[model samples]
Target: NYFSKNPVTGKKVDWYTDFYYPLLNQWAERVRMVTSPDKLIFVEPVPNEFCPTSLAEHQPANMVFAPHWYDLNALFAKAFGDFTVNVQGLSRGMFPLKTFYWGHKGARENYTLQIRNIVEKAHDSLGERPVLLGECGVPMDMNKGEAFETGDFKWQARMMDALITALEQSLIGFTLWNYNPANDDERGDDWNGENFSWFSRGRALPPSLLYYEQDAPSLDNGGRILQSIVRPYAAKTAGIPIHFQYEMNTGTFTYTWVNSTPNPASQTYLKGEKSVFKPPRTGHPALMSLETELFLPSQLAHGRTVIVKGLDPGDKHRYDESRQTLFIVCQDASLDKVHSIVVSLDPPLAPAFAVNDFWGDFGGTITSILVAIAAIVTYFFLL
Candidate 1:
């Protein structure tokens, strides 16, 4: 006799509306009673929704955002296609969200903006609480399982690239959707044929097609999706992240994060800064002795290809081809001051040219004397 849906506030009698909501409050209360200040309890708004404005207030003080992200195009279409591709599904016909959200902006562009917006929602609504991309990955069977048969995961790689670029640009952490050996292109994830697993011996191509492209014993088995997903990240970040990017064609990865602050909250929270007093040269949330582990396609970084500027004395770097990664360490860097770190695979070099180099080693003086004599002879003859 108590079933109801509010037309104004739109509250419903479902568990999510009543039981779960109260349960969350109860959990927060329990945390306040038992948990310490340092430990965190992560929470989400819903499957794909951003954290609501009230979420932060309702949770414990040490909670963080744990929103899930998915390339909506792939999720809706169940295929490796772009956002421009029309989304096809029953829910899409009655509701035009898929079409409208994906509107003319093309796949890569749309996803970047969309993912960025999602990240910003957490920042703006949640107030700098660390956001983790809880679950994200495109299904391998997209584009009608073309990659599985052709053994070319270019599509998967490109799609994953879009996803990774968005996450890194946002400087958020993510745990890819899954790592299920059971995902056959036929059975998928087994719950709803949702096969998003990145590793599978049954699906593994020959050693040649293996990610990292290394000869392996029976233990190691995964393909391009795994390769694309298991790339490098700042294992340790020195400061708040500003931005980072990866150039696909050049296989270049660039990362920037504020590692330190001479003053508190230099990177953000400016509204309250005027109230706080500080000393001069109390530079930004400053950073020094920054270190990053960068991934590359090949082993060694190209000659002089690793560059990190703005450190007090510049950064020290080394490349490991076996691991396909470059490790960089910087002693001093600043957020108020701009700094950059770049690692790339450069192109072949050009030959150097010098005006006198051609004859320098082969008797340059003799050649000059011969030239002078020829000039004198010509002058006399002409005269």
Candidate 2:
């Protein structure tokens, strides 16, 4: 066993400590000197970037954990088919990915467990600091976009559900892998065939589809893929999330949390309303709300509302369609009263993912066109 001399103890420590701890301290000293106090410096250890121990002195006061994850099995298959997807005999044997061990329930458990361990490590290493899943998501060309081409994205949807459930269970925030609407299939991200982008142009938007020509339909132009992967989540919270699950098969969403702070939390947003599932409703919903974006009538999908529990009946909650998030605002906003919540999605499609080093380029042209239409309507009304 290799060891190093402890800085203070004058005793021996594991070999990794000599490098990892100093790296963190050096990172902190450099980041802290240049970075604004308001902004944080997320540190990753040598090699894998997984933090194994609490960063010693010089770690920024607001440092966070940002790590990316990928399932080796899915990467090997170049598809999203996991334990939930069925693969039968003869055809299955042609590839090692379909082998019993890799495609079994145990494999899924291992995936979930790995998430748990990451969260566990962060908590132990950082003293009650925040954890953000820096990057996660799977490639799109899996099975040659079979589910996507058919408009039945349940396979990828199921995988996303498992991923979001794990994050919710761990109470961690995440950013998905990519969203290059212009992602070319042959040269994914212009590097290799690792097309984990949520939005890609593998297939054109069919007339039956809802999007326009310029619109980057999700994961090979599959609406369900976008719908499933980009649903409501608690953006800012009054407390730590304990459990959250959205069942696509049943269209149910449930979230629970324990209040950790006494001060009222700022507003919470449930983004992606323009495209997400909107429960059956008649009148223009997004137009009626201040938080929601005023989308072009054609661009606007019906907005969804949730049944709430544990919240004061008087508190204001709305699904802001424009921003693509759900908002929970309370007059009290006190942690004492709003510690826990349950949001039941009317026709939930379970859970959500990512990509894109940048999110600004994608165009929401419908929004621009809607603005023009609204102006025309106003002018006609005046005339």
**lDDT value for candidate 2?**
0.52
lDDT of 1 by residue, 1-383 (tens): 24576556676666444545567767877776786646676776676665566565556667777877776656777665433432222223635554333321244554565566666766666665677878888787888788778977766776776677667766677888888866666677787778787775575656566456362333355544544565556665555446677655444566665444676534454443321011122344444446666665342243535544444465677777667666777665544444466555555222121112223445678888999999999999999
Off by over 4 Å in 1: 1-19, 27-39, 83-105, 205-220, 265-314, 320-325, 333-335, 346-383
User: What value of lDDT does candidate 1 attain over all alpha carbons?
Assistant: 0.59
Q: RMSD in angstroms, all models?
A: 15.2, 19.5
Worst 10 residues of 2 by lDDT: 275-284
TM-score of each model, in listed order: 0.67, 0.59
- lDDT digits (tens) for residues 99-212 of candidate 2: 333232333444555666666666656645667788787666676767545756555665666666566555567787777766655665565656666665654464466555
Question: Number of the top candidate by lDDT?
Answer: 1
Cα-based lDDT for every prediction: 0.59, 0.52
